[model samples]
Target: MIDGLDPEYLDACPAPNLAAMAQRGFRVNGNGMTPSVTNVNNVSLVTGSYPETHGITSNYLLDRQLGEEFYMESAEFLRAETMFQRATACGLRSLLVTAKDKLRRLLSDGATVSISSEDPPGWVVSGVGEPPPIYSLEVNRWVLDAGRYAMSQEPFDLVYLTTTDYAMHTYAPNDPESARHVTLLDEGLGAVLEQAPGARMLVTADHGMSDKTRMLHLPAELGRYGISARAIPVIKDRYVVHHSNLGGSIYVHLDESSDLNAALDTLRNLDGVEDAVSGEEAAARFHLMQERVGDIFVLADPSTVFGDPSEVAMPAGLRSHGSAHETTVPIFGCGPGLDTSTAARFRQNLDVGRYVFEDVLPPRPDGLLS
Candidate 1:
């Protein structure tokens, strides 16, 4: 999966290899699960379910009892089974290669081999040479190169490759750098196709990137009315260079003394807030984990973001995601089993995993096959 790929990027940038794959097979516009952030959608892709089932509502979570924050990057946080685990139960080997270690940790439950560019082992370094810095565009190429090398060494029944979104976050669709990045990805994809001649190829994105011009601190806004709260940006991660811990959606945790209705009304009337709803309403509408979410969910307009109150000045040329606007993603499938008729069934990004697990190699009712 391409981390931040969108339909506009594919259309504006020249990626002949990907275009050919879409032409030879089928290309359809599919929606991603909301809030459209990396961890939420990536987990949904692997688990073939929504956050309600997988229990990963955000990339970061708050422990209200302990008043501590932690990254939701561990496999233990997942409540649903992954496709890789199911494949293993079926006597099949799966390989997972990702640009970020967080994803490697989150989706490596039942993989025969798992590697990440962020912390490649000595063997991976030897095979692919030294990897580039995770913040650079070359790092994504390194991930694909490593995956190609691994596939050549051993046969894997299922192979999953995911890249980072540094280029997408830094460059606009019309920029020359964006075109170069797409070309690099195309070349890497072609190499993978050559290595596995008969393997089916499915490509999709975790979320789409959007240019954000405004940043809102919901907590500070509520403070004007003597309300105490904390606004957690759902897209916040260790990679601050990509987004500066700003995103289009935020979870507002109100103090016990705050008036919930008043806070919700104030947030809805904010300049950049597109929609504000109670936590229960948000969970039901978005299929999220209710307990993991906050007291209120606030969605910003496409051009705005949510950040800390101290972050008064918006970062120049900042691009981020985590809102309904980014739900639109392109889904491409090629090879024998996938055709126009089959592609018609895919309405969301998670459908890709469902197709592989339920349609391609479903679990037998009896038990593990010999």
Candidate 2:
């Protein structure tokens, strides 16, 4: 999975390798599930279903029972079977390589080999027999390097490699840094093609990217109406250096006596606030499970984002995405056995695993379904 690699950004970047690959195959704008957070859409890609089915609706979750917010990092919270699990049940070998440790745990439940960049020593030793620098701006490249090495040496029946989003989070689509990152990623894609010459590869991204020029403190705004609300940014993660928990979507949990409509109206009337809906309404519209959402859902426009009141300022050149405003991702296929006749048809993140399981690799002859 190419994390945070938007189709529009890809088009604007100077990556001839990726452009050529897209030309040889079919390319279409795939819709990401809302809110367009990384983990939410990544789970959607693997489970072939919406957040309502997989139960991971956002990158950060607010637990009513615990009265606390936490980053989502475990597959135990998933409500549906993943493509990796299904493949293993059918006696197919699976390999999972991720730039982030949390994703490895969340998606590697049934994989035969799972390596994460979080454990740099183990990852490098396993693949190249030597460890590189622990962490750097080129972490995504290292993950891809390991993936290519694995494919060349000990190939698996089903392989899923997820990259990092540091570059997309910090650079504009056409910026030199962004273009450089895309070029490196394209080279890694070429390596994968060489390693697995005839594999029916599906190239796609978790979510799109957007520029955040302003921050909306939803909690502070709700306080104007005497409504005490806890605003949980849906994009919160360990990688706060990227966006500082500021994103286009957030959840506001209100007290029992507060006027919900008044709060909603106050937010809607405010600048930068795009839409504010009740949790139930948001669940229905976004295909999210109601129980997992907060009391009120707040979404921002393309130029704005929601965040908690903080003394820390947003870093320069920060970019983020976690709302319907930037929900379009690119999905395509190349190599042998891929059908390009219906490439123009609309697709969503939920279709990725279904296509891979049903089209790329069908059920084994043993009829194993786990």
Candidate 3:
């Protein structure tokens, strides 16, 4: 999975390798889960399911009893079996190489070989050498390098490679920096193809990126309507340098004295607001975990992002996701036993995993014993 990779950006950028894959195999637009957050879709991609099944509906989770927390980096938040764990159960060795250590831990289950570009001293394996600096733009390249090294040392029946979205979050699709990073990513895929000649490879993203300029201070906005609400951006991370916690989706938990319908009406009238719904409606409509969502859910228009104004000021020119606008991403693959004949029938990001396990490999003699 490539983080924050938008299909629109693919058209603007030059990725000859990916373009070649389209010619040799198939490519189609895949729908990410509603609210289009990272943690939700990554779990979906691994489980061949949606947030409702995997129970990860947002990048930042809020449990009323435990307060709010970033959900993107934790495997404990995942409620379903990962493809790696499933493959391992079927007697297939699995390898997961990721740009972030968080994903390494999240995808690692059932003794799978897991390595990260963000590794510390003793965390990495022997053959898959140390990675480059995590903050560098070359971090994604570092992940691919580790994958190539690991593949050379031994063979695995299943391999998962995921990259960071630092470039996609900070640069426009046609910008020099973004182009350079994408070209490097494409070249890395070419190298992977060389190492595993007959391997079935599927490339997809957790969510797409959007250019959001205007910022809405949601808490303060709710205050104007005599509503006490905690407006939490659904997208947040420890690495705030890129997005500064501003995103297009916000979960609003109303205070005990506040009127829910009044706050929803006020939010719906706000400029740049796309849609606002009650928690129950949100869960049913978006397939979210009802208990984890707030009293009200807000989606910002494509040009705007929501954040707490009290947050340290955001730097100029940064892009972000975690919105309804970033739902469609490019999904494509090539190799023996990989079927693209039904490409037109493709739907959600979960289909990528379903295709790999069900079509590319031998089905479990009976049912998956998960």
Candidate 4:
């Protein structure tokens, strides 16, 4: 899975391999889970379920009871079984390679082999040479190269490779760096397919990306009306350089004295605020886990993001995501078992996982579905 590969990026870059695969098989626009952030949508793709079932609502969350904040990167937090776990139960070996260590920790359950570019194993570094820094574009190429080397050394029934969105966050679709990034990705994909000619490959992204011109601190905005609230940006993570911990969606926890209806009304009228709804309504509308989110959900317009206004200054040419605007991604499939007719029905990122788990892989021995 590509972290932030959208149709616009593909159109801006030259990707002969990807284009050929799509022409031979299928390529279609698919929807990703909203508040289109990494952790939420990655879990959705691996589990073939929505956040309501998989239980990942954001990259970061606040423990209201404990009054602490943490990154939501634990596999134990997942409420649904993943494709790797199912592959293991079916007596098959699975390989997982990702550009971020957070993803390795979050989705490594039941995989026969797991590696991340962030902290690659000694063997990977020895085989693929030293990987570039995670913040650089070359790190993504190193990840694919490492995955290819590992696959060549051993056999696996299932494989999953995911990359970071550093390039997408740092460069616009038309930027030269964006073209180079996509070209590297396409070349890496071609190598993987060449290594396993008979393998049925499915390619998709966790979310798209967009350019932002403004940033808003919801808590500060609400404070102007004498309302007390804590706004948590859902896209907050260790990779602050990629997005500055800013995004287009935020979870607002109101103080006991604040009126929910009044706060919503105030937020709805704020400039750059796209939508404001109660947590319950947001959960139902976006298929999120209600308890995992805040009391209120706020969405920013396409050109705006949510962050600490005091701590984060809006950078020039800032590109980020985490809104309805980033929900559309490209889904491509190729190989013998991937039927064009079946691919036609794919409308969401989770459908790729559904197809792999339910149709391509053998059914569970216990006859139970995930």
The digit string of per-residue lDDT tens for model 4 on 252-339 reads 9999999999999999999999999999999999999999999999998999999886888988889999988999999999998665
TM-score of each: 0.96, 0.93, 0.93, 0.98
Give the clashing residue pairs of candidate 3, or none.
Answer: none
Best by lDDT: 4
Best by TM-score: 4
Per-residue lDDT value at 212 in model 3: 78
lDDT tens string, model 1, 263-315? 99999999999999999999999999999999999998999999875764589
- How many residue pairs clash in model 1? 0
For candidate 3, write residues 227-310 as lDDT tens digits. 888876788766677688888898899999999889989999999899999999999999887887889989989988988667
Q: Could you tell me the lDDT of residue 139 within candidate 3?
A: 84
In Å, residue 243's CA in model 1 sits off its true spot by 0.6
Pairs with backbone N, CA or C atoms under 3 Å apart (clashes), candidate 1: none
True lDDT of residue 193, candidate 4: 93
lDDT of 2 by residue, 1-370 (tens): 8888888677787766666666777777778888988889888888878888889988888999988777888987898778888887777888888988889988889888888877754645666654333234477777788887876767589888898787888788878887778878888888887778778777788888888788778778888778888887888887777778888999889888888888889888988988999999999999998888998998888888887557447656668888777888888777764557757543886677777767766665667552
